[model samples]
Target: MSTSLDTTRLLAALENVAVISTTDLQGNITYANDLFCKLTGYAREELIGQPHSIVRHPAVPKAVYKDMWDTIKAGDIWTGIIPNVGKGGGVYVVDTTVQPLRDAAGNIDSYISIRRVINDLMQNFEAVEFSKETFDEYYAN
Candidate 1:
């Protein structure tokens, strides 16, 4: 296949699997692609104009978000694995990349986040952490 064909295929695959969103500089959600709404169990009307934190899980530490904000605000990209809470309190995990979009003046206009779920890997990690916690509690006596 030609390079252009390969790039097109890759982008199609990414669109199929990735959840994408854009937020204004102050963190209000501006747009959410269909996959994002489906995965989060929110309708487009419900998601638009809401804070991106609408999907945040408490299990994710505040410091992680702080780091993401700090990095993006400085015009750098931030990437990390994040735990998120979906509708009905369901949990999901995603490998996320946050990028700042700059306006013509070189100031940030908005931010785009692309995320892909890592289901089994994150579930296993959560299981291990649970086991560790259980073991610690048992040994504390």
Candidate 2:
């Protein structure tokens, strides 16, 4: 009926899935579904306070983040594919959206990231990995 109801339903439908996580502006693990914990091979206690960078895969470029931040800071949402290295050093790809969380005054306070497994997306890219700058340059318009 309403957006909150829709979100709740979505969460319920996807609760058994294990790849979704929500992070705060500081990159703190604010909320991580069971799938996220299982995928990362970390228990809830170990992840909640940790920065998202804990799972940062070396293959991810810094320039992607540079653009990610620039986009979010400007009050826009960022969507792209991210290849992340798991705790056990396994790599996986996902389509990700990083959105700014704004306060009552419309000031940005945090971020909420929604991700979907995108192994197929990776199959389409000839280059296995991309730098952040490289990604930005290609996507810049």
Q: Which candidate is the best by lDDT?
A: 1
Candidate 2 deviant stretches above 4 angstroms = 1-7, 16-18, 120-141
- Decoy 1 TM-score against native: 0.79
Model 1 CA lDDT for position 84: 94
For model 1, residues 24-97, the per-residue Cα lDDT tens digits are: 99999999988998898999999999999999998788999999999999999999998898887888889999
TM-score of each: 0.79, 0.74
* Candidate 2 local lDDT, 1-141, one digit each (tens): 544667777777777643767677777888877877777788888889799888888878899989998998888999988888768887877788888888899898888777777776567565545555588888996
Model 2: lDDT equals 0.79
Clashes of each: 0, 5
lDDT per model vs. reference: 0.92, 0.79
Cα lDDT, model 2, residue 107:
91
**For candidate 2, which ten residues in a row score worst on lDDT?**
124-133
Error of 1 at 90 (Å): 0.7
Error (Å) of candidate 1 at residue 131 is: 21
